[model samples]
Target: MKVMIRKDSKGTLSAYVPKKDLEEPIVSIARPQMWGGLVTLANGWRLELPEMAADTALPITVEARRVAGGED
Candidate 1:
């Protein structure tokens, strides 16, 4: 298994090793986006995903980690 040692802002030792990454990298996907069926407002445009419409929103946070390999 691979281990990725890192330190947090609180100054603590930590190791991060994703379950998928442990078995080496696998197939990656990159989809293309088309500008069709897009709505344009006074300032910006938006796309609606009626299929994925939800009554509430979820909180999201971004976390950065330094890996030993190349940039991801």
Candidate 2:
């Protein structure tokens, strides 16, 4: 899935799922620190997702990391 990360007027960082609209984000990072690094979601899904360019009009493709003991 291609994810879109954008900054709101209040400066909150949010990730937009293509299927869903920007008004509702797939996940919202606590801070910008998670932008370039690996992030573990509340549901325990870890992703090697990275932030893309602000000026770019492309969505990013992310792969969800396999859980330690979970089936692929």
Candidate 3:
């Protein structure tokens, strides 16, 4: 799935994911912390992005994969 990541006018990071990729329509929005520029979705999918500008709109690809134990 593809997601669009950008910083809102208030300087908060935001991500927009398509409903087709989600299990259900989002009942609420959450401000999840980003760890190393990665955010895990409720559908068990993950998105990783590089360092981006505050006003940058980044298009990122999300895929499902198994992580090797303890790998970061």
Candidate 4:
């Protein structure tokens, strides 16, 4: 699925799923840089993000895999 990753003004990380019309704050990250790892959303969905540069810009949309979550 496609997920938009962004940082809010308060520096909180969030993920927005366009197809689902759902947005949730990222509660945990499997890796410090957050790339090539898993991120858990506040709603309990786990998504695997692709590898990217450590300095990759935010608010960017990228392809991600839904590792664990509810329907779709």
* TM-score of candidate 1 versus the correct structure, residues matched by position: 0.25
TM-score for each prediction?
A: 0.25, 0.41, 0.36, 0.93
Tens-digit lDDT track for model 2 on 1-72?
A: 455555577765455555534233325343455545555443444445655453444343444332353112
lDDT of 1 by residue, 1-72 (tens): 333333356544233345434312212212221112222222221222122222222221113222232333
Q: What's the distance in Å from true for residue 47, model 1?
A: 47
Number of backbone-clashing residue pairs for each candidate, in the order shown: 0, 0, 0, 0
> Per-candidate RMSD vs. true structure?
16.2, 5.9, 7.7, 1.6
TM-score of model 4 vs. true structure:
0.93
Candidate 4 lDDT tens digits, 1-72: 999999999999999999999999999998888999999999889999999999999999999999956334
Q: After superposing candidate 4, which stretches have Cα over 4 Å from the reference?
A: 69-72
TM-score pick, better of 3 and 4: 4
Of models 1 and 4, which has the larger TM-score? 4
Ranking the candidates on TM-score from highest down gives 4, 2, 3, 1
Candidates in order have lDDT scores of 0.26, 0.45, 0.41, 0.92
- Model 3 lowest lDDT segment of ten: 22-31
Candidate 3 lDDT over residue span 1-72, tens digit each: 445544556655455656444332112222343423555544444455444444443334343232233112
